[model samples]
Target: MFDTIRRYTARLRTSERAQPQGTVERRAHNLFEAAAVYVAARVEDDQDRIEEAAAWVSPEALSFGVSELACRAVVALARERDESPGAVARDLLGLPAA
Candidate 1:
């Protein structure tokens, strides 16, 4: 995650330098949006889009967003599987059952 953030930060800086000041009106992509796009991009194996989405928010915010997304996913999977969130998470990661 940190490495992803670092690469995105570099790309963001480069893009910012390339753009002119006060020309384009860009709406800020919140942490949640960034997290969603980042995850979807990863699932689709789109590295560039993942990096671009990661640049939408501060690294700390993006981290929090990603963590929140993971928790939500675990909960949803747990519900679908009729299992506990911890068990679902561990199963997803192939960890030994606790």
Candidate 2:
């Protein structure tokens, strides 16, 4: 899983770097995608990929992306485990069940 996340993030970075100067809108979209990739790396516990992804976007943008990913992940895990989203999130983070 970690290897996969690393490879995916590397590809994203490479593609972004290869692109010529893009419009503000396109850059913003890329940043969001980068953030999502960062979140995936985090979920996979891949520190290297997380750092690589972080370098692709601003700290603020990455934070927002991570928050968005966390919410979505919680919902999905909740459904899979037949538990509340809050519970799933807490459990995933090793927190006491809420």
Candidate 3:
């Protein structure tokens, strides 16, 4: 089982390395839209789209884009709801108000 898992992991890594260099950059360039799609997927509870968007870019780049999207969303929601950004974020995330 361990060997099988290792082989699968290696294959995935090898495929990632074989991808064209600009592929990640090109995908990252459209991260804003990707991030929007990611957020919409979350809101709509669409797991497949979420995974698809996540697979389009490197994890680090996706993390950055998601953070940027969160900040923008907080700002927009705060303005629309006449609340603080932090409050809006917490509310949207179903967290206790801070």
Candidate 4:
């Protein structure tokens, strides 16, 4: 049992390490996704994506007003861009804001 567990754990770690890093790693990304989800959730606009995104946001990231605004901005941009909310959120977050 111990040997099996160790082998699986190693494989999991290796698989995770091989994955490309994305916007979810950034504090800004967390904030953007959280806010977008909260707003989208209330309106039932895109609950599936929002719920998935909400899992990645932390309280520490949501504490800032700037982050909240960024989230709202992402949702708005998602609408205007006619893109998936999650994808738009990631795009906005990946770029340095002007």
Candidate 5:
């Protein structure tokens, strides 16, 4: 779960940087939206692991001050990615593999 959150965060950051300057905020929001797709895509992943990963993608948000909506988006993206948490987060956030 932690890995998945890290991947997602990395991907989102990459995607944000890829965008034009001054669009980081929008990119962040969009990345959050994409998160839903990614999560949805990962359905075979372990639920227990995912639940444990909640620490990373906590709905309460993280230190970055990411909004609850963004967190939900991340989870949604993970699901979209078939529950392949890591891959989905990366896809949504635009982060490369470790």
Candidate 6:
């Protein structure tokens, strides 16, 4: 996961350097950053930060990023617990075993 984020950051830098000086850049925040901040803000009940992060990307993009983050987190937790991802995810949500 960290490797994937690092590669994405590297790609972002390379793309930025390749762009013409006069071109307008998109939002400064990446989707992953936005998703992380947004999720953290929600967990902390920080509406202002949630709004700020949400503004960094389109709603659909944010949703996709959040979903990806959740999947990665579940997989990590599953590995740590020597359990299945589905079981980990269900446990996180307080759901009963299948």
What TM-score goes with each of the models?
Answer: 0.74, 0.56, 0.58, 0.30, 0.28, 0.72
Tens-digit lDDT track of model 3 for 26-96: 43437766777887899899999999887777777778888998898789989999999988888888999
- Across 1-98, the per-residue lDDT of candidate 6 in tens digits comes to 99999999999999878988788876589899999999999999999999999999999999999999999999999999999999998899999999
Better of 2 and 4 by TM-score: 2
Worst 10 residues of 3 by lDDT: 21-30
lDDT computed for candidate 3: 0.83
Give the whole-model CA lDDT for all candidates, comma-separated: 0.94, 0.81, 0.83, 0.68, 0.56, 0.95
Prediction 6 TM-score vs. true: 0.72
How big is the RMSD of model 1? 11.9
- Rank ordering of all candidates by TM-score, starting from the highest: 1, 6, 3, 2, 4, 5
For TM-score, candidate 3 versus 6, the one ahead is: 6
Model 3: residue 61 alpha-carbon error in angstroms = 0.9
Ranking by lDDT: 6, 1, 3, 2, 4, 5
Q: How many clashes would you count in candidate 3?
A: 0
Show where candidate 2 strays beyond 4 Å. 1-29, 43-48
As for lDDT, the candidate ahead, 1 or 2, is 1
The TM-score between candidate 5 and the true structure equals: 0.28
**lDDT, candidate 5, 1-98, per-residue tens:** 99999999999989767867665452133434333433533455656544543444435443233455456667787777666667766766789865
- Two-way lDDT contest, 1 vs 3, winner: 1
**Model 6 poorest ten-residue lDDT run:** 19-28
Q: After superposition, how far is residue 67 of candidate 6 from its true place, in Å?
A: 0.2
Off by over 4 Å in 6: 1-27
Clashing pairs in 6: none
